[model samples]
Target: MPEVRIKKRFSALAGAVLAAALVIAPLTAAGASAAAPVLGTVGTIEAATSDGNHESYWQARYASYNATCYKHSLTESTVHGAVTDGGKTVTLAPFQSSWPGNGWAALIVNSGTSNNVIVKPVAGIAYASPVNNGGQQATVSHWIVCKGTLPTPPSVVTPSLTFTPASCLAAGAIVFGQNVVWSSVKNADGTTTWTASPKAGTVFPANVTTSWTVPDLTKLSIDLEGCRPTQPSADESETVKTTFVCAPPLATITTTTTKTPYDVWDTTLHKWVAGTATSSDVVTTRPLTADEQATCEPEEPELPTTTVDTKPWVDGSWKCGDTTVLQTREVITTVTPTEGEPTVTKTSEQQTRKLTQSEIGTCPLVPGKILSACVGDVPYLSYSVDLPEGFVASSEKPVTITFVNGHGGEDYVVTGQPLSGKLLWPGASDAEPKMWPGWDLVDGQYVETSGNYAWTRLKDVVVKFRVNPEYETTVTYPEATAECANPALTSVTPDDPTDPTDPTGDPTDPSDPAPAPSVTPTPASASTDNTLAITGGTIQLGALGLGALAVLAGVGMTIVSVRRSRKA
Candidate 1:
């Protein structure tokens, strides 16, 4: 509301003294005349005319001022001096309005004065003339004696204030195990700050109900008389209020758990190796021992084996004896008992017939009586004489048999050869020789010594001894002439040699045959193959394979394989 600048008219020039000012504006009075009010008092409040708004405090006051209000009502009126802005109410001094109805009231105060007041008529509604409360006309008469505008001020009152205890809480809360008690505050200016606490030495449980006392303002007092006449005065003490608190809900609680898993192991390295982890809640691992590794990973195989059968041996046996072999074999022999006596019908085979020249059994030179001869060479005649009447044969020392050939050729050896005692003798091959004794009757003992005979060298040296290792004993041969020409061995019937003349003057002693062999069996031959060294080592390749092959070939056929190898 705008300040009313009262221009005193000649008739109203009765009185005017200015010190401070205020203008009271209120809500409208429904539909009454809003004319510029005369110097009349209506409803104790003016309408909000086309003026600006103002708060309850008259900030425009320049100095101390005297205020008065007149009151009259059909009921005891409670309004002191208040206004409403429709939604909110402003209060002022409760300075009692002491006059009777239509009488007067007054007060003295400085600028910035404040007080509590009743907002309006209580228990009933009332208003002044020309301003009705709602639809009812003024059952009450009210008026205010206030300055409207600022007076040129030269007077001022100043006072200092101190809030001694500053401020306090309205409550205390249990923090941890102790109560955070709040203290009260009081100012030297008669102001107070209210607070609450568990009285001294008092404690409370957590989250307890708690509160603080609202301080009594009436207990407060102000002194303005001491203020110098030129300073602002302290009006009244203001009330400060703060909230209280007890223990809050207990602090939030929490728990934690961790998770993990274990691991496994492997094998194969003879040691433990790792495998996939075993899953669990907590973090974990484990080393695998040999036993555990067997269960965890694929067991490492016995480091795989690779072998090459290097130099497999070729096993074989001669026609005469068994030899060493690499593989295995088994032999079985069955014995049968006969009900009757068994016959040993042994038909012995003879490889040689007793040889003779000119007469049978004259020279008596048993071909293999003591030494061997190559049986496959050209047949020849060799002679020997029996000891005369007082002589004997002795084998006390080693005797050697050397071979000499016709046509001034070299000598050769027939040891370890396939020789027959009665078969046609073989011819000499290329080599050298030393001579051996025919016989020597020394000290009544006949010793066959070796030395060269001082005789004319003969053209041909024939041998009559042969030896065989394959066909032992059951050996036979055909007669042979000394000729191997045309290379076609001529077939000749096996005939016994039968030429033997007397041992005359100079014959038979110097060119006698070597000592005869203690005769053994010889293999069968036609005296055709001359180079008979060793023979018949054809292996039978296991009787099992041979039988299987023969069976597969249907009883009449056999399978044989021949292969030649060289020895380095």
Candidate 2:
């Protein structure tokens, strides 16, 4: 609303005095045409206004100016003034304004005056005029007196609530708690009213009635809604019952189970080894029932078909509980009665036989022998010896056997005597070979030893032979012969050895074997960054040759693999 400035027509002296009295312009009734308002009864008040918005204070004088209202309908009266509740006093010092036909009444308190008044006039507070001979005089009955000091209202601090997540329950629930302390004020009627004013970062709980258990503490916050009760109740001191609901904790738990097969005690290895059969599974949340647990257990193994002492196989049990695994196992032994059994006494046997060419075995082929290094292979021989008549080899008395061989040549030689028993071979020079024991065949493989006799399980019986690798030009290996014998047990049959020939040629033809791939050694040059030392040769393949070497190595490995597969 725009402020309406009312101008009072006064003499120059009176205007100067009014201006000196009040800094702000004074308000008056517009177009009154009557003498200035005569000051009526006056009194001072120390009071405050209690409007719906907020409280406001005032300390000012009230007086009756006795001005006539231009419009006098009780509902539309545009005349107003400040007075007591019954219109006893009114004053124009704290002035007012009125529009003749606009039906709006306003009071403008002098902010700069010495009266010490601060008031915002309540809107729509209008007064009716009294009947008179000329016009109705606006009375002061409609004006409300600003009275009685409003005592300083007590400060009410509302309790607050904060939520913090925590593990409050035992494995099943998630929860939170509240902390509050209510303040109260005693009313004149001997009744106590509880109130709260929440601070920042807090929320007042809504008036709810759902209840839940919080394990940490007992007391909970209840909103009684200040002076107003949520329900109709005559008792003012009873505590109100309120409740709230918390969301349930949600989670997904999983479990995985694995079963291993039972182990068997190996008599020869003397250790446990995994068996061939078992069952397993993985599960989540779903626990096995009694029948499922029984059905999933490993079945008992059948008895062994032996009438001797033996260890029984123990089958273990396994099952999945709710998010847990359970297993059990036990071992037992069994013994059989032994009374009427025939104990056969065995005896040792020394026999002599000639070993055939096939029994002596062929030497293995050497592949990719580009170097002049010595190489040897322990051939797989058949050590099948026959027993003497009417006597059998048993666990108590096994047969004793041995093998021997001798070799010699002009250019190269293996000149060891049969059964001299020393680890010696012809040197690089033309010296006689020293006595040498053949390799022992232990666990189906030949192992070198310094003994005159050979294990009965030995595969081959032959003299150790060597070839002179000092030939000036590329040369083929020459044919040679040797004799092998056993003085105490057996001798080797001297079958004529077949001359080695290339599969595509005649045996007697004097042609060189295929020239093996050769690499002539050369000093590495200063510019070469990559060098590989391979028997008598330093390959200078530069930087890019690393990749080339990798490719060639792969090709060589593939060729060797193909050759082995063909031999197999």
Candidate 3:
């Protein structure tokens, strides 16, 4: 029995060895006969959907394995292959997988014959590193199988971009962070580049906030791509724009007018001609023009008035008759005899008798004609005589006497007027005998009397006068002056009163008295005689008290004279 058992065991071992050979020999032969070991006849490998929502399946086939096949299972296998779906090549890798034949084979039964067969077909086969066996070790054909057709990739909807600051930013303005939001981003290639508009080669995060130094205030754009990076596109968000300004520099201005005289006399005109004096001669209490008034500035004051007198013959007169007879004669004559006397004279014989006319001639004769004495060193002619009754001297008559004093000193007298208020001699009308001459007297004084008078009647008249030594009078005037508050900023110039354009009008006009001119002192010629005198009846005097006068009645009247000195 041991021998018979040994034989059967040997036969069984041999049969088992033969079956192992049958399984191993062809694989070895197939490996030797074929060019390379290949997982062939790959049925299909596909992703469930293009939306990344469904799973992927890989179906593959291996060459026939005759002997009973062994199975090996695989977990987490990565399958990679280029699949054409709708003419577009798409690559995929398996993330997970399962296998019922332990990743090796599947069982099958022949329908016609009652034969059970073990077949190794690569249906539902799981793969790991499908190309080169994950490291150049394995070779396999790959195909994708899907329940439905693969969908297209979603359109690349570019993200919207925006800048913080608007246009025209000032210098040193802070640049804030930017906002980048996505509308849609579906890239089959799994790689893309995001870029800024206007070719801002700045890098940014995929889907997050980003920041960059603004090189300058300018327009910008943004771009997105799955294949490669590109410049900003027109489809990017709205553009940006800004400005800057500096403070204006401070400005300064200055204005000025020339300074000129206030009052002056024109010597060539000979009259009291008005001319511009120095600015010092102007007296400005208030502004004259609106422009000046706005400044509220004061000007220089005016000069004071200096007065002079030129009357002559003080308290002296020309006598035409003797002291006794001159009083008795009704009207005196130019020629009189001093040798004859009106009273009877006693004869040498001592007889108390009326002396004969011849004897009277021998007696002492009363003085008849006498010449009036001259007063000052200035030469002046004088005449006096008794007047006739019926043809009386008109009180208004003006005597024309040449100024022998050589300086225009000839003066006339008006009768029947006060010395301080005499009507001017040679009055305006000849018919009015009482009217005196107006302004015909020189130096505003009469030759005879230092008193004012009116021409009341025609009668005897006595006068004496002299002329002024100088051509023009120099007067001292008072004035007020002002200073500018800020000389560096502005300066004030005194106004001229003598200017014809002076809107203040004439100072002498009672209706509009101009402000006084400022005082500018200057040296002048000295006066020969400081005292003035008059010998006529009445003399009208000025504020300076230099005047003469004359008085006349039906009959001739004696002349009166007076002398006065000017105030120092």
Candidate 4:
């Protein structure tokens, strides 16, 4: 039993050693595959394995697909393999190989113990390993032949555009446009580049319609054979094109005028006053001609007067020579010619005549007394009367007449005179005097009259004279002066028959015969004496003496009378 156990243990040990060998072989091969290989083209040899194997051998057989494989110009090559000792580990390599022309290449690996091997191509057919084992030998095939080159990039066409007005033909009207002409372009890669058209400096015709089109283009660049061809090779067989629309142009113009509305004024009324006419109030349809404007002139207004005091004098007063007279005269004068008359003439035969003195006296004089009569009643008389200085005469030609009382009255009559035409008074002419009532007599004693005058009577006058004529005039006489005359005295006696001391029987005694028992001085007789004296004596003296006696009698009557007897 111990021998049996020992034998079994030995068998187990052998199996263990074999299994260890199997695992270690694949691990070692995987480690070796992890290292990168040196790449080379088919038919070219390069060291690929750390054991010094050539890459061309692998690529020429399995990498190249048994037939010779040439390098592809623009693609990569790859290869795949597994371990030789029945392991699951695989190895792979990528190769970047280039050739001058297009061709085919292949890679190959040896099948160990008749196991199958696989190869895969990478970027280029450089070299490859067996698919199942690392210890297997592999080879590649390379065949060289001329393949077609890649196509060149298509050319880009530059488009064109323009604008024109479709509606009005004016300068600033809205406008539309059409595609314009442009150049085409070419690219290096096989790709198409499109470009939009530009519109700078391009003008379309006025009022025209058109369209745009893009034509099919040819391949613009040359191939290795220097042959130009149309686009869309055997791989792509379609054509490209485009279309566009066009636009129109517009029109232009301007405007003007000749006149304005603010230049006219109206003058319809005869005068220029407020509310008559104003510049803005007048409207003019057209401009006035120079002649029409020049002919316009304003009219004049009529003169006005008041009837109350139209003449030169305030009343009928005239400024005659210093004295005025209530005289009348027929004046001879030429009149102002009327409208349309040629000349006025004076009448040859006594046009007017002076009033006779008798005619003047016919008008009753004012009832007041005469205060002054500077100009006497006479014909053809002119004199400056002596009137109180600074006294305004009722009339410049004043005829002063102070009445008995202080009342003043006047009756003046003036007529146009013959020769000198009534001797034009200071403020009067040959014109008739305009008379007003009410005299404006200020402080003064007299008035004077001037002008030709004549007097008919001089009654109860003070003094009168005529100047310039040196004519004698008469005045009424005044009363004469008187002297005092004395008269005889008469006596009164009392008679009695039985007297004691009587001889001839004269009853009244001369003295003290009988103190006639208190006879009252008969008031009647005293009053008679006063009357006689008042009537007979000088008026001034009798009045004074009587006045004194009256005063003494009144005082004495107030006192008591005392009588005394004399002892004889």
Model 2: weakest 10-residue lDDT segment is: 557-566
lDDT of 3 by residue, 232-301 (tens): 2221111111111111111121122223332333334222222332221221222124542333223422
TM-score attained by model 4: 0.14
Q: What TM-score number comes out for model 2?
A: 0.16
Every model's Cα RMSD, please?
58.7, 37.4, 48.5, 61.9
Model 4 spans > 4 angstroms off: 1-102, 111-126, 131-293, 300-568
User: Candidate 1 on 422-510: residue-level lDDT in tens?
Assistant: 21223221111211123233443334433222111122233322211111111111112212101122222224221222121221112
Candidates in descending TM-score order: 2, 4, 3, 1
TM-score per candidate, in order?
A: 0.13, 0.16, 0.13, 0.14
Residues forming the 10-long window of minimal summed lDDT in candidate 3: 477-486
lDDT of each: 0.25, 0.24, 0.23, 0.24
Ranked by TM-score, the better of candidates 1 and 2 is 2
Ranking by lDDT: 1, 2, 4, 3
lDDT string for model 4 (51-105, tens) is: 2223444344433233333221111122322222222222223331453223223
Model 1 misplacement above 4 A:
1-311, 316-367, 370-403, 406-568
Model 2: per-residue Cα lDDT over 1-568, one tens digit each: 2322233343344445545533322223333455333223222222223331111221222212221111111112222433422332233222233332221222222111211122333333322222112222323222322322222334433343332322222222322233333455655654344444444455555663223222333222132122122332221111111111111111122222223433444555343445654333332233434543343324423211111111222223311111222322222222212344433332222323332222122111111211111111111111112222222223332322112222222232233222111221222111112111333334433345544332311222222211111101111111111111111122212242222212221111112122222321111112221111112223322332222222221011000010110000
**Against the hidden true structure, what lDDT does model 1 obtain?**
0.25
User: For each predicted model, how many residue pairs clash, with residues at least 3 apart or on different chains?
Assistant: 42, 9, 91, 97
Over 4 Å off, model 2:
1-120, 123-159, 162-165, 168-568
Q: Say which candidate scores most in TM-score.
A: 2
